[model samples]
Target chain A: MSISARNVFKGKVTELKEGPINAEVEITTSGGDKIVAMLTEGSVKSLGLGMGADAIAVVKTPWVTLLAGTPQYRFSARNMLHGTVSSFVKGAVNCQVNIMLPGGSPISAMVTNAAVADMNLTEGTPVVALFKASHVLVGVPV
Target chain B: MSISARNVFKGKVTELKEGPINAEVEITTSGGDKIVAMLTEGSVKSLGLGMGADAIAVVKTPWVTLLAGTPQYRFSARNMLHGTVSSFVKGAVNCQVNIMLPGGSPISAMVTNAAVADMNLTEGTPVVALFKASHVLVGVPV
Candidate 1:
């Protein structure tokens, strides 16, 4: 079977498997790549990635041919911020947001109870998450 | 305070996150660059990035500098047949192994439960993750 992968996927989450403290999502890509993404239990609930939920997966291949010859992720004085809410952790006060960056990587940030109430952040709310380039840690393979 | 960033932390995850889903980690570089990394509930434990945990982080400049350079990840068909395991995920009855090629990055393959039992796979165990250059998909930033 030929597996066609795209840079981004706009699809619905078909299945959600919740382990004791971990979770996995099955996303049916537009091109039909049954992509399975693992997330923390908190993230699963935070993002509300429930069955038949619509979501987007942005893939970044910085070293791949299309983006090759470009500088890899670098830290600088310039402010660089990017992330996507991949999952959620339901909290008594506020829910935690699991943010996935460009590199098929994920990060976690807490949304204050007030902030969540103010922004009314939910599964589909497109809230812009920001961070400095300095916040990113780059690692070369050994 | 100026932060000098470097890519030095590199290792396979031996554990994963526990509770709260999202936790923030600050890394003080040798040059005193306080790099902040987000740990998702799903990955925190698996990454073993606990207090004073050591790993390599690859740092480049301009973000595009690493992209404008030649492809850092390259693999030969023959070498793919005998590569090391860069990452793995255990399924109900089988396991998915992400083989680390000669260069950085990884390719994933599925192995049966028996194979995993026979190989006695562990976190640091090396197994070749192989794929063709043609398998790589490249694209411009959207």
Candidate 2:
């Protein structure tokens, strides 16, 4: 179907965890980055998710957050990918920063222009992209 | 900088419309797709937004909604794109569905597995992805 969401990664199911209300599945993208997705227990069973299953991790760009500098404190986010500022798209209210991960995978982040200025996210700035596992959607090939 | 968002689109501001409380800015991606973003009026001015400025549109996956069949009723969403189902990764509660746009752009979406079966979204299923412009996060490159 047609949608505006980008950031789709084809991955493989490396592990699966089932719970009462929700379940989590870990998928390793083709680029070697692992993504975790949480869904309902019924979905896990109906999807026949198992080890070594091919899957696609669906992450929206907005759900992906960008950080300018590294802090010593720990956060609750489950996913963190490191990369350099690849590009910048300035908008009236927000700016889009592209963080190029180690395998040449570029993760895009949207932040306010004020935040961009406050963080000084320019080209080549080292930053981290963070997102919650629940924000990740995993899809298997038909 | 290092917050919890990813998926950034760097584009040029082709249009800007300011309302009483909120404002809408349209950015054309390098690939030529124009994405509309809505933010507060203060954000628009504080960012020094104007015509033909560079900007970014940040959108989270939860802000995205996927639909398989075409409906007769009109909706209030600001953006909608049509594509074909490229794949589906099922989870316990939700399924990640990837739709391949016309330009080979893949847009990912999250839906329940029951919705998947209800919509019958297999590979190659025609569907439409919809989202409101207000859900988009706007930013400028600092």
Candidate 3:
């Protein structure tokens, strides 16, 4: 089936930490980008996930949060990628921003037109993308 | 500022979408699931999003899709959460399905009676909840 999520990264499981209620899985993409996912203990067991496992991390675009400037406050989210704005597209209410990570990974984000103007963002601008570990969905190939 | 999204979970940017006019974002919730949103490029810039930024991803309940049984096909939606039916309330046209994620977080989905019956969903039945990145709304704390 055609999935609605826009980002799919195939990676290897580098670490697995299990808790009573949840579990955290770390995936290292071929592009050298690291993705961390938090799921349920049951999911971890059901998927039979372990270190060195080949897994796929899936993320949808709208859930990506954009940040500018140096982050003054530390965030609880696990993933933080720094890159420069490579391109963008404007729309009636929202727009798409493309950022190229230093590791050669391409990331995208959707924001409002008003926020774009407020931040005065443009191509070549430095930015950050944030994602919480729990938002990541990990699946093994069937 | 307050928004219309009924589901608001604080997380960071995990994935993003690049589109002609709009973009998709994927956010990992603290409770160990991801949410996707579609917005304009302008909104992304205005919010100053980067990886690791403390942001809140929001989704309206109606935007959530529910699926039962094991997924035989791949879906494009960014957020696919596997959980159990905690509770539900039926209405004339739409019914709400409350799913309990592994981390003790609750996710609510609005589906049709036909779908519930078709899926044979019950209080303890396992199900998958889906969200497209475009349907998610990303925001940074002011």
Candidate 4:
């Protein structure tokens, strides 16, 4: 099947934490990077998620926000990654920023052009990429 | 290293079509779903990408747009997928909509609650998910 969803991660399930309403599942990629996904508890059980099972985690790019300079403020976001700016695609309204993570995997973020100036982003600038766990979607490979 | 890039697809490059400044790469996932990514020709050469090369494509979720009901409009977006609205999570400002594609993979989209209400989305609603090829970030497995 062809999918319009741009982000797709495949890994083995390492942990599954189920709650009354939501659940957090961690999948470790072959490269050893970990991805955490937050989805509905009903969906979690319905997918029969368990440790060692193969799974995929998907998150939209707009939900990802980049923090340049020092991320002086702290929030409850489950994923916070620090990396150097690898590339920049400045668009008319929204700017696409790519940060090269430690493992060589790059994370992309879409922000307004105004924010780009405010952050003074360019190649080699250090930034933190963050997104909420609830924005992640977990699906099993059939 | 730990990172926040939520979407990661491990696949082998099945086809490579190079253009003047940009290139389109086709990757086939383990489940046989093919994904197309558009990136700079510089990146293409730098990554030494060729047919049968292993690569990873990262796309921000926000790059994904969900269109409820039959999409009768024409757009330049390269990727358009049709799926059923498998799940919905209504939020204060935006709602997270998950569309289950034909191969049992679900894609997540973040849309304003106003848009959700405007579209009258419900379970089993058929919709088209669209995204641009330029919005995709292609990376080599590290």
- For lDDT, the strongest prediction is 3
Residue B139, model 3: lDDT of 75
Give a tens-digit lDDT track for model 4, residues B1-142: 5444444556789988786766778876666656677778999999999998988766555567666544333333455667788888765444678887675556667654545677777889888876656666787766
Of models 2 and 3, which has the larger DockQ? 2
lDDT of 2 by residue, B12-57 (tens): 8988877776677897777776667777899998998898888877
User: Could you tell me every candidate's TM-score relative to the true structure?
Assistant: 0.29, 0.53, 0.54, 0.52
What DockQ do you compute for every candidate structure?
0.02, 0.05, 0.04, 0.04
Candidate 4 lDDT tens digits, A1-142 = 3233334456788998987755788877676667787755555777788899887665555768888775589979988777889877665666667787776556777678899899899999999889876566565665
Ranking by DockQ: 2, 3, 4, 1
Q: What is the lDDT of candidate 4?
A: 0.69
Stretches of model 2 off by over 4 angstroms after superposition: A1-3, B1-62, B65-127, B130-142
Q: Model 4 residue B107 lDDT? A: 66
- Model 4: lDDT of residue A69: 71
lDDT of 3 by residue, B1-142 (tens): 6666557878888877655555667777777666666678788878887676777877677567666655644443457778889988976434678888886668887654545676777899887778656457677888
- Which candidate number would show the highest TM-score if scored against the true structure? 3
lDDT of 3 by residue, A31-134 (tens): 88888888756568877888998887766555578888757888898988888989876666666677888867787766777877877889988988888886
| Poorest 10 consecutive residues by lDDT, candidate 2 chain B | B69-78
Rank ordering of all candidates by TM-score, starting from the highest: 3, 2, 4, 1
Candidate closer to the true structure by DockQ (higher is better), 1 or 3: 3
Each candidate's clash count: 47, 42, 62, 9
Whole-model Cα lDDT of every candidate shown, in order: 0.40, 0.70, 0.72, 0.69
